[model samples]
Target: MAIPPGFLDELRNRVSVSEIVGKRVKLVKKGREHSGLCPFHNE
Candidate 1:
């Protein structure tokens, strides 16, 4: 099934990226963006 328009936009607005990512990784606010080490890569 196809998703309706504005659904993703509304979801993104409702959810928090930092909040979700912070649960798995430590995030540091760098200006307007959040910085963190990659959990998938061995770098």
Candidate 2:
């Protein structure tokens, strides 16, 4: 399923991608984005 770009932008504006992802994994802010070891593959 393809999501609308406007909807994606609105959702991103209302929430932090890192925060939501942080719920399942530990994340650290690196510049403007988040980074963490991948748990699935243990990178």
Question: Candidate 1 at 17: error in angstroms?
Answer: 0.8
Q: What lDDT score is found at residue 9 in candidate 1?
A: 98
Which residue runs does candidate 1 get wrong by more than 4 Å?
Answer: none
Deviation in Å, model 2, residue 16 alpha carbon = 0.7
lDDT of each residue in 1-43, candidate 2, tens digit only: 9988699889989998888889999998899888988979966
Give me the candidate number with maximum TM-score.
1
TM-score of every model versus the real structure: 0.76, 0.70
Give per-residue lDDT, candidate 2, residue 13.
Answer: 93
Candidate 1 lDDT over residue span 1-43, tens digit each: 9999999999899999899999998899999999999999877
Worst 10 residues of 2 by lDDT: 34-43
Decoy 1 TM-score against native: 0.76
**How accurate locally, in lDDT, is each candidate?**
0.94, 0.88
